[model samples]
Target: MTRREEIVDVAERLLERGGPEAVTMRRLADELGIQAPSLYKHVAGKPEIEAALQQRALQRLAAALEAAPDLPSLAAAYRRWALRHPRLYEIATRLPLARERLAPGVEAAAAAPLLRVTGGDLTAARALWGLAHGLVDLELAGRFPPGADLDAVWTHAMAARVAAGPGPGVTG
Candidate 1:
């Protein structure tokens, strides 16, 4: 792999292991067995590395979401992905994204599937995304009580939204 790709790979590992704070240039360099200054030769710095990782995460999520046959499947895919990659999801969804650093369309691509599944209703799309993210975040944070039957919770919540029906002129 190319040096930049290698750097990003290692950065992802660090992020998965310890969240954003664990992904420092010095730490990355240490993980890669190189001097801290040498990381600059391959990547701009931590922010750039983070942007790259976010792009990757979004691209993968978009692919998963796009492949879903229905809203429940879409919601399941969203939850499964977030739970599998909690730190990556956390960083990718964090506010004040480094949009300028990301490749063009990465953000929109990630959202497009949700928009489509919501029948182009932006509010509904946001609500679905919010529900999925909030539930995953709570689960990751251990906020749910033991044996909460989260699968049922997800199904009930999504069923409620689906039953509400899309807004005017909307079709899913």
Candidate 2:
């Protein structure tokens, strides 16, 4: 990999291990066995590193969501991706990126599957996206009651959403 790629890869590991606060230039340089100032040659600073990581995460999420057969499958795929990569999910979902910093079309690509499932109904797609995100966030936060079957709950919720049809004013 290129030096820049190497730097971002290590930074992402640090972020995964200890969140954004842990990924300092000095720490990254030390992890690379290089002097701190050398990192500047590769990355402008922490913000650049974070943006790279976020872009990678978004791409991965878009791949995961792509080609899902139906809404339930899409929800399941999203939850699966988040559960498998909690730290990445945390960054991808919680960290707000400035519009200019976002890789062009990445966010829309990630949302495309949902839009297709909703028959291009943006409102319904957004509502479904919100439901899936809320469920995953709650589960990740350990908010579910003891003995609760999360998979069953997720299945039931998706079923209910499908049964409810599209949101008000959405034809399908």
Candidate 3:
């Protein structure tokens, strides 16, 4: 691979091992066998590197999300990705910047996978995003408590959402 591509791979390892804080320009330089100044030729700074890394993570996650056939399968796949690639998944979702800060093509590339599944309407799409994203985020955070049957709970929740429907106020 080329030098810039090599740098991205090294940065990915650094992110996978240490999360955001572990990836410094100097540390990346050290890992890359190049001086810190030379490193700037590939990535502008730590901020840019972090953004690129997050973009990479998002693209990976989007690909995984796309491979699943449906929502339950998608959730299972998401859990698997989170469990297997916790640091990268975390970096993908937890970058400490606004959506605007993300690279121009990165979010679009990453979201293409999801947007394909969530077409037609905005409200339904928003709810689906909220449900899936929230569930995965909570699962990663261990919010379900120990020894609990998350599969059953998740099924019930999904059922309720399906039955209740995202509509006008139904409360009595």
Model 3 per-residue lDDT at 137 = 77
lDDT of 2 by residue, 31-120 (tens): 999999999888788788888888888888889999798898898899999998887887788778655888789889988999988887
Of the pair 1 and 2, which is ahead by lDDT?
1
lDDT by residue (1-172, candidate 1, tens digit) is 8989989999899988988888888999998899999999987777788788888888888887888878998999999888888887877787368878888988899999888888899888888889998999899889999999999999999999999868665654
Q: After superposition, how far is residue 30 of candidate 2 from its true place, in Å?
A: 1.7
State the weakest 10-residue window (summed lDDT) of model 3. 163-172
Q: Least accurate stretch of 10 residues (summed lDDT) in model 1?
A: 163-172
Ranking by lDDT: 1, 2, 3
lDDT of 3 by residue, 42-126 (tens): 7667777667777778878878887776556766776777778888887777777446666677666655544444443335445
Q: Give per-model TM-scores.
A: 0.90, 0.89, 0.77
Predicted model with the maximum lDDT: 1
- The lDDT of each candidate is 0.87, 0.86, 0.71
TM-score of 2: 0.89
Worst 10 residues of 2 by lDDT: 163-172
lDDT at 92 for candidate 1?
77
Question: What number of backbone clashes does candidate 2 have, counting pairs of residues 3 or more apart or in separate chains?
Answer: 0
User: Model 1, 36: alpha-carbon shift in Å?
Assistant: 0.6
Clashing pairs in 1: none
